[model samples]
Target: MNNLLLNKRIVISGAARGLGLSFATACAKQGADVVMLDILADEVHSQANLLKKQGLKATAWQIDLADASNIKSTIDNVIAHSAQIDGLINCGALATGVGGKNMMDYDEDLWDRVMQINVKGTWLLSKALVPYLKASSAGKIVNIASDTALWGAPNLMAYTASKGAIISMTRSMARELGEDNICVNCILPGLTIVEATAYVPQQRHDHYVNGRALNRKQYPEDIDGTAVYLLSNLASFVTGQNIPVNGGFVFN
Candidate 1:
């Protein structure tokens, strides 16, 4: 084991699958106890069991980001069970079929749902967990934003706007939590090929692959290293920054 995150207890939202699952697995590999949260209860439990079978400390919780009450209660239960939380990976978000629509053509309901889950949900969960995080000796928050937020991607206004909000929130949160020894940072991932993104049009996928410096497909595993580093001691001084794992799609 690398032991980079040894003895740490980390919470990963959206951990049933996709990038969130990858993060949980990576953290656990490095010796961190992982609390995996997702709306898909069965999937989350199965994933957690798989980790346990690997002799790793892992647990699953079902949570609906769109529900504030659920978020609070779930977090409270997490704290009650885990006793302390060292880090958080905010990967829970809502990006259904809202892409490929013009700003004017965007569905109001879809836009509202995206905002509620992606923007408000991220903030509220972080807000509710801040107290427990502050109590830890090493507190870190890694918010998963999108590269589209950096260079606006056409036809993805709602998702892009929500991620932009995440970046801004990360900056402010870093400042506010600095005194408490909490480090907040944002990771902007490129167009990764995940189960959730299988519905993305082929043309859009090609556009992302062709425009990248790598000129290849990006996967959830491509982001694990950066996420692990940000949550590990290596990033002790890194805060309020936006790091891109987008195959150099947008240069920082």
Candidate 2:
């Protein structure tokens, strides 16, 4: 609403629903031209249409983020659509469902798939988009991480490991991209109750809520301000940092 991002172009992954959609909406409200990428083609296009109706310049692309070749083409298309990209929000993730398996019970294929999408996808997508971000004097990259990566959740080995890699990547990207005036950071979100979490076992949900200082589930809105702040000029001095959007769930 303050027009902090006016005339800027932003790209968000996983913008079909949940936190990613929230980020897209917020950026649009601040007058940013947004391009959303998601595996769910119909849902993403519908959302983009809605944003367009609201007078925001928005577009949608469907792509499998796990493949490096696909990521390169997707990033190139986005850059071609908009002369420059000012920010990127890597909010897409996978491997959130199968958590009850122990080390022995975990399937190798499942583990590999998790790492491929959650870790490799984020890295490749960021790498592919760096050139566009670098073209802008004020560029920012925000990767969405999870609290599970902090303390580590039992039976969630693959998801935790991938998120931990995201945290590490954030710092490394910041260091490498700073010279280009692009700021890279990570956001650690807590138990944000979205449609996806409905599939989570009740016991696990209770476990997360009880551990939080607020003793409540987090909502998509909880991360909005933090996301905007990190991408705004106010955070010009901030880079290689991790800001937990969880309700004090994990103190670091």
Candidate 3:
């Protein structure tokens, strides 16, 4: 119990599995009351319950990123129950239709769905929660992006583009919310080996691992420390920054 996030109330999207679940558990371990929101209702609830059994403050909610009404209603419900929100981790994203498809061959509907969920969903959720965030003494937002956007990986145009938008939006949000003392930043991860990414091809995984300074694969745990720092008081002065946790894959 490092308690780095003592007394803070944080909300995490896509908290059922993969990086989202990792972040939820990490925050809870640091003494933050976490609200885990995911489309996978049962898995998320079970995860929260497991944390509770460990004597951590954790709750779960189901949400669909594509539905604006659902996002607003879920947030409202969270506020009604949690009363205040101190931080937000936007890890929810649609990465489907991203691999092995060039721009010319990419399906229109798939591209639209990816953008709608990854870009628009992130914006809407942040916009809807800004009020509660502003009410906190130290409000912070961490937008999960991908290093693919920085280096422009091949065959993943839509995913990379949507992440690019997230980086841009993080900058804009930081400037806009600076007046309200809300800090916003983006985290660009490399090819992390999470369950959600288990489908990634072996060659792709090797490419990421071999190109890294660490000469190893990145995992969900590799990102947890930076996330904790960003949401902690230690990073109050840090905003509008894009920090890559990709084991030195792309140096900025």
Candidate 4:
């Protein structure tokens, strides 16, 4: 544990499992008190307990990003319990089982769901937390996008579009928040091996492996460092950047 984030506090969405849990664990290991938000109440709470048992500072809250009021209430609660939120990692989205549909054939409701949760959710959470973050000395916001958006993966248009929006929004957020010493950035990670990708077809996985210059499966840990670095003082001057962390699958 480098404790790069020592004396810091971070909030992460989708913290029940997969990369969300991994990011939470990684940040906590760096000595940051974490607030893990997810819709899975039992699972998120359980995971937070596990982290606490490891002598890490973690708190879990069940939240639905699609709800604006819920987002506000949750942020208020987080501030009440833990003041001075230093960073936010928007890792929550509707990715599992949301693939396999062609762009033209995508169900209207499904596409809307993706946009509502992935795109609007990121906006809402970031919007609500900016005020608190502005109060911090060095505030950081990291939106977890996808390399699929950059590579233009077929048959996953809705998910890809939603992530693409996040990349764009990160830049705009950074521009507006830069004056306040707050950095907003996006991470376009490759297809990683996690519970969330269980439904992804094997052919897609092979495509990433073969196309990647690294020629290996990407893991959550592979990109966790980028998140940690951005949240730390190392990335104080870096803002409004969309970084691709896909092992050379796509150069962005």
Candidate 5:
């Protein structure tokens, strides 16, 4: 436990039981107060309880990031309680299960749902939190993206498109927030194993694992350390970059 994030306050979205949870726990271990927000009430609360058991400050906020009004209120509450946030990890996203279909087979409604959460949610949440981040001496924003966004996947047209938007937004956010001392970056994770991936076809998972240079499946832990680095002093000079944590799945 190096207190890389000592006394810092971080906000992690979709942090019930996956990559988001991993980041939240790791940040806690590093001495940062963590606010976990997810749609699942019981699960999020359970996670908060676990963190508390470890003697970490944790709060669970039930939120639907897709709703602008709710996101606004949530941000107000978070800032009110924490005073200021040192970092923000926009890990909330909706993919195939929530409307990621092949381009030709994709319905407009399904596409809208994915875009609303994955792209619009990220944009709005970050926009709302900009003021707090700007006020911090070490402000960082890490947007979770997917490698398919870079290479473009066929069946996951909507997910890929939304992620591409996220990547673009990351660069633009970095440029705009730089003068304010806020670092905006995106992490394009490979096919990492998580609750979300349970819906993915087994063959698809196998394909990703076999194709990766590492020839192994990616776990949530693989990306947790990267998240820590991006939010710490170690990455103070880094911004507007899309760093891949996908084990050479889609080298950029």
Candidate 6:
């Protein structure tokens, strides 16, 4: 929480709540000017105001990741406000209430929705911001994936597939952006306690808690330190890696 991120500006998606909110707070604490983007405009604005009241640097913008035009406009406005975008945290996704069905029971609409938001959203947002990231002296990208994808978690096929794709995309993005000195990486967190995972079955939660080597529940905060590290100069040499931050629930 020192001045590691001082003078750095980071844009976090899905910042209205859940894990994204945790990332926003952590980045602010580390002295980064935080740009919070989410479809929940009111909530993100309120959260940014809260950060401001805490004497932290934060801004809010509404962005629908699934909509390309919205993403382009938001990116332009973000640049207009400040041309330098030092980092990006791709945490936005349609996670809440998108589970509880087996792959066979999953409808085409459900699968497409998950892919459009979770997979395509990550791609589109990163695509829109890479130019700014490339322009930075040191640029970093952290794509939030999931342990479910590593373990092939049942009844969550579509959602898991989307996250799996993110992990792969992280590697490809890193290679493409490396020439610009932009480091792209992925984080695979076990099922953490957040608003997005509130609907998860108790049984699944128990499995995560008991299966982990730590033998404890994971929270959004558990993922923050790793995120802060990846976003800072501390990880300047790191890129295209899939880090599993699930307290040893599953090895990647």
The residue-by-residue lDDT of candidate 4 on 16-62, one tens digit each, is: 99999999999999999999999999999999999999999999998
Q: What is candidate 6's lDDT per residue for 114-203, written digit by digit as tens?
A: 899899989999998898898899999999999899999988888899999999999999999999999999999999999889899999
User: What's model 6's overall lDDT?
Assistant: 0.94
Could you tell me every candidate's TM-score relative to the true structure? 0.98, 0.96, 0.98, 0.98, 0.97, 0.98
Please give the range of 10 consecutive residues that has the lowest summed lDDT in model 1: 94-103
Write model 1 residue lDDT over 68-166, tens digit each, in one string.
Answer: 999999998998897789999999998767798899899899999999999999999999989989999879999999999989999999999999999
Worst window of 10 by summed lDDT in candidate 4: 96-105
Over all chains combined, what TM-score does candidate 3 have? 0.98
Candidate 3, residues 128-239, lDDT tens digits: the string is 9999999999899999999999999998899999999999999999999999999999999999988768777899999999999999989899999999999999999999
Residue 145 displacement in candidate 6 (angstroms): 0.4
Residue 170 alpha-carbon offset, candidate 6, angstroms: 0.5
Model 5 accuracy (lDDT, Cα): 0.89
Off by over 4 Å in 6: none
Residues 134-165 of candidate 2 have per-residue lDDT tens digits of 88888999999988899888888888888999
List clashing residue pairs in candidate 5.
none
Error of 5 at 181 (Å): 0.8
| Candidate 1 clashes between residue pairs 3 or more apart in a chain or in different chains | none
Give the per-residue lDDT digits (tens) of candidate 5, residues 1-252.
398889989999989988999999999999899999988889999999999998998999888978999999988888788777899999998853843356678788878888999999999988888888988997999999999888877688888889999999999999999999999999999888888888888787888888889999999999988999999999999999999898888889
Clashes of 4: 0
Q: Residue 121 in model 1: shift from native, Å?
A: 0.6
Q: Candidate 1, which segments miss by more than 4 Å at Cα?
A: none
Collision pairs in model 2: none
Poorest stretch of ten by lDDT in candidate 5: 95-104
**Model 2, residue 134: what's the lDDT?**
88
What value does the lDDT take at residue 249 in candidate 1? 86
